[model samples]
Target: MDHIRPLPAYLVQRYHGWRATSFAENRSWYRRLADEGQRPRAMVISCCDSRVHVTSIFGAEQGEFFIHRNIANLVPPYEPDGDHHGTSAAVEFAVTSLKVAHLIVLGHSRCGGVQGCYHMCSGHAPELDEKTSFVGRWMDILRPGFARLPEGDDATRQQALEFEAVKVSLENLMTFPFIAERVESGDLSLHGLWNDIAEGGLMALDPRDGSFHPV
Candidate 1:
């Protein structure tokens, strides 16, 4: 007697097709990937926004990028407490373990988390419901972005703060020892990106011009 594995019929069909493709491409592709380990060329810190997927935007093959996602794509300064430090752990693994050469901090337009941060900063922090809501707490990492903004109306200020959060996170990335070492030694380079999901626009910051250009 043989044990029967359980899986969705559609998934089983897809898996079979994928397995056939893999077998034709490389007979031992799974063995190779497992033995060789993940060798990603870049590490991307991006927002949890469903529309701003890194793999689709970058057209990267599977296992070609080390990805980390959080609210507003923040990189908090390294704190040596009992804090979970999920983002820090990802950065450490990408830099120290994977030795990825490139790092990208991605931001996007119309982000609900960024809007929530703006509302919290406007003396409305207490109004946010504490239960079943992690956005308020998760957005604390972007506090510096609000501080950097000039006093203005809600919409103007929120938009400015949202973009500034990307800069803040990029700055925070330097606080990690491994990241800083690699950046200073020219082993790693960091990039900032803004994806306008609604407009279908992809803009990447240009170091030479200090401006974002369409991709």
Candidate 2:
């Protein structure tokens, strides 16, 4: 793959810095992890947004959290079609093999993916309506969330859909038999979180009222 370039100089420098300090300090821990394997207690599904740092937000140590990031941090309904379902595969592995104690779906404000979904569903993004558009097809998962949002201005509707996306993911996670079983048996728990990137604020979904509160 001649097209594939080497790591950028800045990233290389950052890696070296981390290797010299954090990796150096945790050398033994790293080795131990390699030998024994990772046993992360939680599986975090979050957006692929660079600004949203899941581990840093939770102050999680290496091997402490299993993270899977996607365009909108979505979990599709359980479909054993035997196709290439990346997100579903990750969820299955986390629940069945990793046996994670918790599964968290994290959403954020000003998400481009969510905005795209809003536009597509609201008839504002005609290009995404094409059958060949991967993003459009994938964003179908959020359409139900978009439908749940009340009529409002573009900004308000976008924010509402963002919250609904997390709720949608949580509901989809339950569609997985293993996940639902674990939840019923008290072996696993599910959580939804929304992050405000600009304000550096986090709100957690309350199961009682189905509302988000500051965390």
Candidate 3:
């Protein structure tokens, strides 16, 4: 306890402001949520980038979305070799327990993780190639995506990798037996999306054509 510090001044101030305004206004709703537990209809997997606001984009209220954010928003194929699997556990809970109807993987333009992956795959970043680099190891999941990138400049190719991040995650998600069973039974659906951060434009993947269309 002595080693830990209190909340930063800004965060504390923000908490006070929220408690006075939003929390106060939604007192009853918050209480109901606590009493009844959550029943979110969808689970969204998004990037750890602060610019990617999943709740703001969808205008989601607290308790309305079950969100899981990570580097590159990647989902490794189901590997039950008894290791720490945060993303898999979250998915399992969302599908098998929460029974969320939709699972969405949201990727964005100018993602640092994706960019790192591009450089790593290009052999330009030897540091990230080291076994000790967690980001490097994680970005390995996007290697398949990088191998098939379209011919273009770095910017174009990077953006393509961003979309690939979403596609890879969508594919890996199906490797889960629970998710596969639910999808097969029509009880669950999967979606892949890409967001242009500065432009605020969204693109949805047409799985049939393997192309993204504006949404």
Candidate 4:
């Protein structure tokens, strides 16, 4: 608490602007959202990248999506060992409680986490290889994706791994019993997408070919 400080001037000013305009214009909508709670139709698992604005990309209004962001947008296999699992908990709440009809994994190009995993696997990032490195342990989830990186130039391989990250997460999501059950019953669907940050291009995964095509 002692270390906590007030919001930065820029962010505070932005908040004031938004509150005066957006919040004021949608006062009833905001009140209804608070009163009825969120009932989003989709759960988006995306990277914790400032550039990857999910709501803005989808033109989604408040309460339209239940989003969970993590490094590289990785989702580890389901392991109920009583440990704290933030991503898994969010998925559980979204699926079992919220009953989101769609679960989307959104990976992006130039992902720092994915790049770190790539370098770590290639033995170029020693710091990330340290036994006590939380990033290293977390990135272990992407090893399978790394292994699938196609033989190519640096840019191609990086983009390939980005797509693989989305694929790996979607695969891991199915490992959750509840999610698997829902998919089996046609109650939910899974999707994978890769975003090219610079060009604002989106590619969707074709499960049949295990390849990404422009969306």
Candidate 5:
């Protein structure tokens, strides 16, 4: 621990404040959650964007939802190769181990990751086109989604691609055999959600029409 630096004064002060307020108010609940283990009914795969507040939108308490955050909230296709796959690993644990009834992919408007993919694919971002860029490689998963987007102006295209990203993640989630099995047996349900960050509006993908409707 000698190499570790001390926490910043502001963050330390904020942590102590939370520990005294929220933690104190929910002391018994927190202790019960720790003792019983988390049995979250839903597993939410969301973007790492600070503006996308999944817990606040759903009013989810601690231990109520298992959240996995990453760039653009994407779920790549299932690949069984012996390699490190963080997203797939999380999905396996959520489905097989946790037995979460609902798996939600939450995408938000103006996502940097999605925009990066958009620019990269459109030959607008040369930096991201480099093979050495980890973000570029990761955003490649969204290439197919971008290709499917209808032609439009920059703003319209960006919004369409955002929606496509959610659809793509939903499709990829089904590529996992375990997930597919549970979904087929009606034990698991998949959902796609897009949040309008500035407007605080949410859109839910309708399974029947394959369209997103404001919710």
Candidate 6:
């Protein structure tokens, strides 16, 4: 066995204690939820980053929000193939089946998938050929946005390009028929967000200013 750390064990025991108390006091709350059905208010589209957990960030309980995570948190244009479409399938289930009122695209700083896209577009990445990683295929969806970036190799340009990827995903979200219909009917709202892990702050896209604003 690996080294036994006290921190994780301590956290687990304390967390279970809290959970037990909560469950005891609100046992009917869970039973009532089973009797009824899930009626979450929002759906979150996020990255498959270990550092960014939706339930932890939103302080959500068990059945509060519908969450879907994928490489780079991309929302591809609806195109059905025989292949398994995990992200798109989750979105369809959340929007069509659950009928969530809000769809939040949560982007964060220092995303490895986004960084891989940068390296691939910059021609710095080696040819993987038949050994392509999942990030390669996932970042392929953002190729258009990457190609649209101005020629540069500065840190500022790289950061800007990363944000551009998120903007691209926001636009791609509109490609879904159900999402578009809901937006048109004012039944659903789509929001894009950028979380600064270092600063512990959030920036929301402001159409008026054409920039991200503090949230």
TM-scores for all candidates: the values are 0.81, 0.97, 0.98, 0.98, 0.97, 0.84
lDDT of 1 by residue, 1-215 (tens): 37877788999899999888965687676567788888999999999988888898878766788999988888888786887988888998899989999999999998888888888876676654364567777777778888878777887788677677788888888888878888999999999888888887888877785567887
**Index of the highest-lDDT prediction:** 3
Q: Cα RMSD for candidate 2?
A: 0.9
Please provide, for model 6 over 1-215, each residue's C-alpha lDDT reduced to its tens digit, 9 standing for 90 to 100.
57765677789998899778988788998998999989999998888888887887778997899988888778887887778888888888998999999998888888888878888877777551125676677788888877777666756566666677677887888888888999999989988888878887788888675477889
Q: Per the 3 Å backbone cut-off, how many clashing residue pairs does candidate 5 have?
A: 0
For residues 42-125, write the lDDT of model 3, one tens digit per residue.
999999999999999998998989999999999999999999988999999999999999999999989999999999999999
Off by over 4 Å in 2: none
lDDT against the true structure, per candidate, is 0.83, 0.94, 0.95, 0.94, 0.94, 0.81
* List of clashing residue pairs for candidate 2: none
lDDT of 4 by residue, 28-66 (tens): 999999999999999999999999999989999999999
How much does candidate 4 score in TM-score?
Answer: 0.98
Error in Å for residue 207 of model 4: 0.7
Models, CA RMSD each: 4.4, 0.9, 0.8, 0.9, 1.1, 4.0
Please give, for residues 1-215, the per-residue lDDT of candidate 5 as tens digits: 78999989999999999999999999999999989999999999999999998999999899989899999999999999999999999999989999999999999999999999999999999899899999999999999999898877999998899998899999999999999999999999999999999999999999897789998
TM for candidate 6 is 0.84
Itemize residue pairs with steric clashes in candidate 6.
none
Model 3: CA > 4 A from native: none
Candidate 6, position 204, lDDT: 86
Error of 6 at 203 (Å): 0.7
Local error of candidate 2 at residue 37 (angstroms): 0.5
Candidate 5 regions exceeding 4 Å error are 1-3
